[model samples]
Target: MNTYKQIEAEILAASNILITAHKSADGDSVGSSLGLLHFIEKLGKKATICHPDKAPDFLDFLDLSHIITMDQEPEKVNTAFQEADLIFCLDYNSTDRVGKDMTPLLESASCTKIMIDHHLDPQDFASITVSDTSASSTAELIVELIELSENGSLLDEKIGTPLYVGILTDTGSFRFNSVKPRTHEVLAILLAGGVKHYMIHEMLNDTNTASRLRLQGFAMSEKMEILDVNSVAIISLTKGELEKYQYKKGDTDSLANLALSIKGMKVAIVLSERDGIIKISFRSKGKVNPVNALAANHFDGGGHANAAGGMCELSMDETLDKMKALVPEYFPVQ
Candidate 1:
């Protein structure tokens, strides 16, 4: 029997439920939360979705009007946190990932906490946890939960659409090493259940403004640097450049991956200056687990093995230099 059979029973017993993902919401986090929201509502339970802040504008088509963002509606989020009998934390490994403003509320909430995540070394905060580092995405694990629910018919269009988006984005459209045969199997089922693949692809990748494209071009031409000796590439963007280009939240979503497209590049780093901090993203190839070892040890961040993110209080130059220096230590050149 599936381990989630116990979680299914817990879901059946709960009344008011609250769902949440990490701050600076990504497609996987948003998709998993909304997908689970639809599923819980189908079970006739009062379910509410909340995020520490707003999601990206590109995700507006997912019917997220029901989601309560603490940045926008703090009082409502507070009320929901207080009233919920069960709280589902998705995608993030720690309560700190939910933002400082949200940490206190979550810490005080007298509810059963359930964590469903695909990250490494999760803190023991949740009462129940379904953590698998090998899973492609949290949405994939959520599907496992749904199948174990006895009512397997719950994987319909409403639930499948966001789940598909989660898996698609986290797996880099099914190109990442984490994507197993079962990942493709789940995707096939979602497609058969009415996930509009071509349309979603267009909306996510093709629906970009001219300024966004120009910004990417400028970053590649002027800001990108190659360290051939270490097989690493770096792209740094300043706050002034972002303002000049009319940058939006998701503007740099594909920048790191773009650098990785180079033939000999084994690792790509993107450093963007924001709010007096340098935000860092690390993408690596092969067995060099940046998320588990490099990001955790140096940058105070962790995620998947190949893709991870971190932040530093240093200037862009200092951060870039630090990352360049660490490459040899984490991923020595052959």
Candidate 2:
């Protein structure tokens, strides 16, 4: 746990700043970036948010529409990297999670690097690292940082919206096990800052497209699997299936919640194919920590005890077999 005074000193010292998050940016990644962007600009410094890919449509409601995307020419993004005095990596701890494409920029950047994340593994790239897995979301941490800064009085609606979004998504709308009293305190402050509750809720939950809805239905009907007498549930979607359904990014965001609907399920796993690799997101209902099971079996990922993630290079069939083999080890019959 790094001190806020040190982080404040770093922020004040920086002039031109580049803020970025991991690829396939989700709510926490996008939300944290936007929230920090407002804070950086309020300090009278130039800030730009960059992502390895375009954010999902649902998150487009945020002001990241102009951030450089990964597909842009490297020279274009590197130009910003070259001019930046500091780089703020948010939400993800490791640079690999940010994307292999940005490896050169991350390694070559002459700017001071700061990592503010909630992930389990902390990389050594940052000059200053502020990671707290106990925090509900990186957005929550950003709010705390701003409150500690001289701009504490400047947390307006522009900044409050994204922070609230991060808190909402990371906590599963305050329904997950990570929800804490401090989380509520943060929410109360954001609400007081004029964050529109209904608008943010609609942006996240009510703005689904037809293609996304159809994709969800197809996944529920065809791809869901129950294992070990309903103790575990798995949902999977391959690249071809995603293409056939015209799936857009973020379509599967809520698919893990389907497992929570089951009466006796203890663990739920969602596997998706992206970039020729299998991505696994794990959710648990009780004492199980699927992230440990993932790390033990050659998957490089982890997160909270109740919610975590990992990735594997195996084909879908092989990945399924691996998951099936691992389940019995973690959840034995009493």
Model 2 poorest ten-residue lDDT run: 288-297
Compute the lDDT of residue 9 as modeled in candidate 2. Answer: 78
lDDT of 2 by residue, 299-333 (tens): 77777777877889999999999888877777666
**What is candidate 1's lDDT per residue for 139-237, written digit by digit as tens?**
999987886678667678898889998999898888889999999888887888788988888888778899999999999999999988888888999
- Measured against the true structure, the TM-scores of the candidates, in listed sequence, are 0.97, 0.94
Model 1 poorest 10 in a row by lDDT:
287-296
Give me the runs in candidate 1 sitting further than 4 Å from their true place: 289-291
TM-score of 1: 0.97
Error of 1 at 59 (Å): 1.6
RMSD of 2: 1.9
